[model samples]
Target chain A: MREVVVPLAQRSYTIAIGEGLLDRRDLLAPIVAGRQVAIVSNVTVAPLYAARLRAALEPDADCVIEVALPDGEAHKHWGTLNAIFDALLEHRFDRSAILVALGGGVVGDMTGFAAAVYQRGIDFIQVPTTLLAQVDSSVGGKTGINHPLGKNMIGAFHQPRLVLADVGCLATLPERELSAGLAEVIKHGAIADAAYLDAVERALPALLARDPGALADTVARSCEIKAGVVGSDERESGLRAILNFGHTFGHAIEAGLGYGEWLHGEAVGAGMVMAADLSRRLGLLDAAAAGRLRDAIAAAGLPVRGPAWPADRYVELMSVDKKAERGTPRFVLLEGLGRACVRRAPDDAVRETLAACAPG
Target chain B: MREVVVPLAQRSYTIAIGEGLLDRRDLLAPIVAGRQVAIVSNVTVAPLYAARLRAALEPDADCVIEVALPDGEAHKHWGTLNAIFDALLEHRFDRSAILVALGGGVVGDMTGFAAAVYQRGIDFIQVPTTLLAQVDSSVGGKTGINHPLGKNMIGAFHQPRLVLADVGCLATLPERELSAGLAEVIKHGAIADAAYLDAVERALPALLARDPGALADTVARSCEIKAGVVGSDERESGLRAILNFGHTFGHAIEAGLGYGEWLHGEAVGAGMVMAADLSRRLGLLDAAAAGRLRDAIAAAGLPVRGPAWPADRYVELMSVDKKAERGTPRFVLLEGLGRACVRRAPDDAVRETLAACAPG
Candidate 1:
């Protein structure tokens, strides 16, 4: 097992990444504060792992309740988030009770958000089942639901008490979902670590093949980078914005295409490519480095080309992104292969990048 | 104007309490950051003060948008909150844009919550018009919408950038609404200060008669106590829970009676009497002190006796209160006249208090 501690002083928590760590009572005991536990999973994950997690927690918890929501990114909204609240209230789960989020990103986000607003705030644990969640969403405290107008427009920065990412859970992830997770893995490397990016490129084949060591290593490294970034700037006041390297464009893509149509990682994968192209256009990143980053993303079975939306349409959508301050859209572009910086791109340069990277 | 600084480190803010402070451009200028500002007021407050606030902010802000929501506690829900988000998105309000809550507690709570969850978080100021809001809700950062199941159940603890309590606005307030605000004023005194409580008791007639000096002093003193409590325990982990002295029973009364039937302060007024009775039963408060507390509540033109809900029903309702932990309802009971302590009352004792305080 590998542990990466997010040093947030009093709100600090640990992300435990390993194979078969789900049922570890020792790992779950310290964080599970109250006797009552509500394991919030989705329909897809509930049928598979909810029972196992419940059994694991049964001995420790006085009342182990399960609320399995309908699965999908489309289900990530007020209605679904309220269902978690309703269940918590129905079961008489109090502030001291722990809410265990036991699914993928959608589940984790909604559960974390539910915990954030449930009775002002409650302790919650993230048990991410997919690689996308394990490496990205579960580590950071950015939990929220999407609005009709914008993705993640409504949410809170509520950190979890503990995050348990079982590498073995990845065995069940769909191939596309696994690839989607790699999009964030590649993002972590593309933003901060060149050696990690090189390692990811070398381990692509093994990672796709579900090699336990490669998956564990990748998850641990991604979480470490994320934990480090999140630790320094918990509220995204400055340095933390780098983590959204591809997210502005990715969010626009997700919102434009409709939330559930393209998985978050898929949009991020394509968005990263567009961002690199924009970086190259701005003379911040050399063409060869941008090309290499695209190659790595593609090698991980992720998309390099964005959808053929008009440049103006993309601009319009991106302008509404959360990263956009005042009226200017802030893009997290690569300074080189391994470093990211937030910059406002010229309209023509953004247009050129859109024109170059859009699908023919 | 009197300023009470809530010393919450970087998130610290001030409550500026005075008469006619709303139209003072000097007070609103420093806190209202960003060019774009949205004044979230209700239908009632729109005609009254929104224009004055907009006129004051116009000199500093480039764009001042007004969103007038339907007024009342019933309107404090997701639909209304989403409307704020929709307007923000439609108008393209960014993270840097400011949302000024220009109404009563409902407006302040919803607007603060909207700011909290809007684009992860944004800055908001509270221009509390009602005494309930000016003295209480606007000072602390307890912003949220109510759920169908509970009051203030779905929300975030997002503090305002500034709180402007214009004592002059109280001139237009309904007599009942003015009295409702007094409940919170009484609560601050009952929980923290004996002298403040005595002053409130003595100033009841003048306060009810809308004596500006008396009202300002009362609001300033109440805010001072609240600012101190909130600064020490921002997240309600320990000392802050004392601020909810009457709130546990108050919330149940509000929820049980169907929100809006009785104003929040009215419920809290009766709830405080019940809490005092329970404290006396626990031997923490003397019967004479409890009676004096009830007498003061009545003197403030607030309800001292609660509606006759069966004891079991009160127990059931209070059990689901956010303050309840691990299936036990935590009551913030008065220790004699001034100090407050959080304690779990025996079920029968709580039942007795309910029976004693319930209307015959």
Candidate 2:
């Protein structure tokens, strides 16, 4: 397993990436701190892995409880977050209580946020079962619920105490979900590591074939890159904006297409392509690289394009994205693979990018 | 003006307490570091001091936007917070945009929360126009909105860079509100300083008469006591819970009677009395000291007894308070004047206190 610490003092936690590492007492013991445990999972992941994760947390812990939320991005709202709070309060969870999120990005985000608002804040562990969470959301401390007006419009930059990405759990993940997770892996490459991008491109076949070693390496490398960026810019002050490379265009797609209709990472995959295409159009990137990027995403069997929702709708949706300033949308544009900067391109360029993204 | 610092590195700010701190550039200068300002106030405070505060800020700043939210605790909700966000976003507010919250606790809590959540976070100043805010809420980093399920159920610990509490502003406050602010003033005395409590009792007449020096001293002492408590226990791990001396019982009153029925400080005033009485009953407090504490609040003309609310209702409301654990209520019981501790007293003790609060 590889470990990457996010460098936040006191609130910092290490991300553990390896196959079948969830049951490792060495990693779990230090973070849990002899507190009562509450495992928050979802219906989909509960039956598969919750019991095992709970059993593994034990022999040493007591007063443990489990509350499973309904699975899916659709449930990442105030209601779902309240259920976790209800469970915490009902179970008498206190400042010392530890919440273990045992699912994908949705569970991780919601559980972290619940910990944040529950008595100002509490400690939570991220046991990301999905690849998307393993590399991206699980590493960053951003936790919040989606506002009807925007995605991730409300949240806290709450770092986790520890993260355990048990790749063994991924065996039960749906094919569509696995494809979605790749979008984030691709994001790390696009923003900070050209070599990693090349590796992902070259090893797409083995990674797709669910080769455990390749999958684990990709997750760890993605985490290492993210941890470095987050360490320097914990709250997306500057360098972290690069991590949102395709997110500006991607979030617009998720919102314009109507949320839940598109998996976040899937929208992110298509969004990365849109950003690359825009960079190519702006002469900031090579057309060949853009094609390679798009082809690799397509080769992974992820959607590359969708019917154009109105450009205006995309604009409206992007306004509420976390990267948005006041109301003006901030785009994380590429200088090239492995380099990104935030700036406002010409309106025509943004409109054109939206126009190009329309279904063919 | 007396100044108190929260002492948190990078996120720390000062609380300036005096009769005319707002008119002084020294306090405002350190906080308004930029050329643009956003003064978030309410109609009640805007007509009174917005122009003056804006003038003080404008000499060194430009493009000031004054967004007026409806005045009152009833408006401290998600919709109102969103207005602040919308205005900030609508104006292309950068991270440097200074948000000045220029009203009482409601405005401070909402705007501070908005600053905390807006674009991950931003700079804000607390130009608190009410005494409750000046003495308590304005200095603490606690920022959030009341959820449908609980008060402060959604929030972050985003501290303001500066707090300018012009005691002169309190001159225009209505009598009921003035009395309400005294609850926090009394709270400072109850939890930390015995001499301060004696001084408050001695100076009650002058304070009621709005003597500038007397009022300013009260405000300064309160902030100093709060800063000391907060600096030691920023996230309420221990010492900070003492600051909630009246709040545990107060939240129950506010939630039980419905949010708008009693202003927060008013409920806190009554709640303090009940807690003191409970502590007396528990033999953890001296009966004479408890009586004196209750008398101090009552002499301030604030409620010393809770209104008739069902036991089940109080229980339901208290469970959602920030101090609650699992469905169990946690009350901050006074050991004596100037000292408080968090303890789970018996249900019978709480019932007796409530019975004492029943209208004859």
Q: Output per-candidate TM-scores for chain A, rounded to 2 decimals.
A: 0.97, 0.95
Predictions' DockQ, in order: 0.69, 0.34
Clash totals for all candidate models:
0, 5
State the iRMSD of every prediction, in order shown. 1.5, 3.4
Give the per-residue lDDT of model 1 (tens digit) for A1-360: 888898899999888989888888888876663478999999999988888888788887878999999999888899999898899877767667789999999999999999888877888999999999999998779999988777788888989989999999999999999999999999999999999999999999999999988999999999999989999999889999999998888887887887778888999999999999999888899989988988988988888888888888888888777678755898999999789999888899988888898843
Lowest summed lDDT across 10 adjacent residues in model 1 chain A is found at: A26-35
Q: Residue pairs in steric clash, candidate 2?
A: A89-B326, A92-B326, A308-A359, A326-B89, A327-B89
- Candidate that would win on TM-score: 1
Per-residue C-alpha lDDT of model 2 across residues A1-360, encoded as one tens digit per residue: 777777777667788878878678667877665687899999988988877787778865656799999988788877888788777766656677889999988899889888876766778899999988998888779887776555665577788888888777778888888999998888788888889999998888888888888888898899999988888888776877788888888877777778888888888888888888888778888988888888988987788875467777777677766567656777777788878777777767877877876642
User: Model 1, B177-204: lDDT tens per residue?
Assistant: 9989999999998999999999999999
Model 1 DockQ class: medium
TM-score of each: 0.95, 0.84
